[model samples]
Target: MPTKTTVPEDHRDDARPQFVLEALREHRHFVMCAHEKPDGDVLGSGFALGLALKAMGKTVHYFLDDEVPRNLRFLPDADKTQRTFEGIDPSALYVFMDMSDRARADDALAAVPRAQIINIDHHLGNKRFGRWNYVLEAEAATGILVLNLIGGLRQTVTEDIATCLLTAIISDTGCFLYSNATPSTLRVAATLQDLGADKDVITEQLYQTRSFSGQKILGRVLDDFVLTDDGICYSTVSQKLLESFGASHEDLEDVVGALRAVDHCEVAALLKESPDGSYRLSLRSRGRVNVMEAARALGGGGHFRAAGATLAGPLADALDRMLTAVRAEMEAERARG
Candidate 1:
């Protein structure tokens, strides 16, 4: 697909740009938010857009429900992010970023006293849950689209903005190692780098650092890792395991990635017990399995290679059911040969 960057500097009939342009025209003071458990993609994209809007002299309230992970604190203006909507005007429009469902925004979104919502996301299963939904099913990350949106708004792309957007793309694409990272993804990365995005700074903060508790949890996961005969590797991060290691949900982000690195592991799954008592499953496929289909079969959504779902626990049974779908998909794919 052609990057929409070279289009004439006028209104195009494209729905994505039209939605963003319309929202900018319609809303002045806006509450920009992300998913409940915020990750780099959502936070980075939301913050980048926030910077762009603020540059235009608009009131932007960056609201996030979850505690920002420790490693991502180096973001230029992330310290200003809010967890509540208090003291802000009730009349502000709400912009949901990197997430489709309002429920994913959690309670922080509930108090927002506006009916107008603009949803910008890159999820395949986004239900178009906004007055204006600018979701791109094929975009690697929302940051990629937000970079285009910044250009759409005809705003200057500052170095700080480039860093935030670059972090979003790198985090979501697993450092451009995931299947979602395409030629266009790299082009965006190259452009961001040219705009002064510091790869060393981002890598130092995100990759070179890991909490002691997180490392302990990784040790446990590796010790108990399971590799089935069918090349399916899985790990567990139950509430009990978390308590034992004094680990937070934030730390398990890379445990699945580590599990995926094992030789001959076609699929890797990390099932963690969420604080809300549901089992959150993060899955990765090394090409032999369609994890997205497996996730959707169990009522979740994401890319073909990386997908996720939160199942109501008892985690044991939910994990079993999810794995059943994954195994079936693997077997079906193998049968296709």
Candidate 2:
């Protein structure tokens, strides 16, 4: 077993920040990896860190397990990211940011050889899988911690870097509307704005620039939406629906958020069929439910308010089993009262 080191929220001051800074200084090259299905939080923060490393005159490789979502293609220098490792430097630093598990980094993660890994994330359920775990549950996104490293390195948070970090914060926090959004989060946003992060353009690009394909998929999801008497609203987007709408998997990304917006919904779920026939499940809570717990029970994990899991499917059957677990948890919560 790899020895795990954990940095709790309170102790995230100078010690762990220095560990990351020192690690970057000691290594000449780095292969930076983010979670599969690279969301804005992961990709934005990853790119921000890559730019910072390049600015310091260090060589950096941005690798992803999944292709960038069509919506986020406008992110800073996203074109440079590679799906394969062109050259492996055994000594090159492997830095996994914004994700909890190494497996989430990609299938290629297992093959990549690295002397050291610095795990940086904000998820409370993180396994402390790296040599250096600088995780702070208090942070809305890992990008906040990366900003700390930039400051400690005495590097500047240039306009581009600021924009990337700002997107990470907003994407993970639902534009700072989620419960995890704190006063500090707003402060970070304000600072990013003052640094010229262009909130108007970033928000427009992220939320408003939806494709017509995405719109049709969203419509299908909402039209078939179902809300149970217990306040659990559930739905599915089958492969057939996507095929008919000319939509891709990425278009279904925001559908769960739309489901959560339904009035009287305590928990909302969206399950989309994968090419392999497994269902990709996304769960969102209204703060009254711990959707993350449900996700973990189904072998997935995410934040308290938003969580996800993938399960073997015939979509309907998987939905039944998972919903049984979620409904039971809800019943238990009521029983406790």
* Top lDDT model: 2
What's the residue-level lDDT of 128 in candidate 1? 66
Candidate 2 lDDT by residue in tens digits, 1-337: 1233443433334335666666776678987788878888888888889899999998898887677887677788788888787875667878888877887878878765433677889986777677666788789998999888888777899999999999999888877788778998999999999998989887887888888888888887899999998888889988888888888877777789999999999899999888789999999988777788888889999988889999899877898977976887677667877
Error of 2 at 181 (Å): 1.4
RMSD of each: 4.4, 4.2
Q: List residue ranges in candidate 1 displaced over 4 A.
A: 1-15, 110-115, 275-277, 335-337
**Model 2 misplacement above 4 A:** 1-15, 335-337
Would you estimate the TM-scores of all the predictions?
Answer: 0.90, 0.93
lDDT of each: 0.81, 0.82
User: Which tens-of-lDDT digit does each residue in 1-337 have in candidate 1?
Assistant: 2333332323223346665565675567877787877888988998898899999998988877667789888887788878677756676778888875667776747655334677788887776667666778788899988888888888999999999999999999888887789999999999999999998888787777888889999999999889988888998888987887788888777889899999989999988987778889989999878899898888887778888888888867887887798998898888998
Worst 10 residues of 1 by lDDT: 1-10
Clash pairs for candidate 2: none
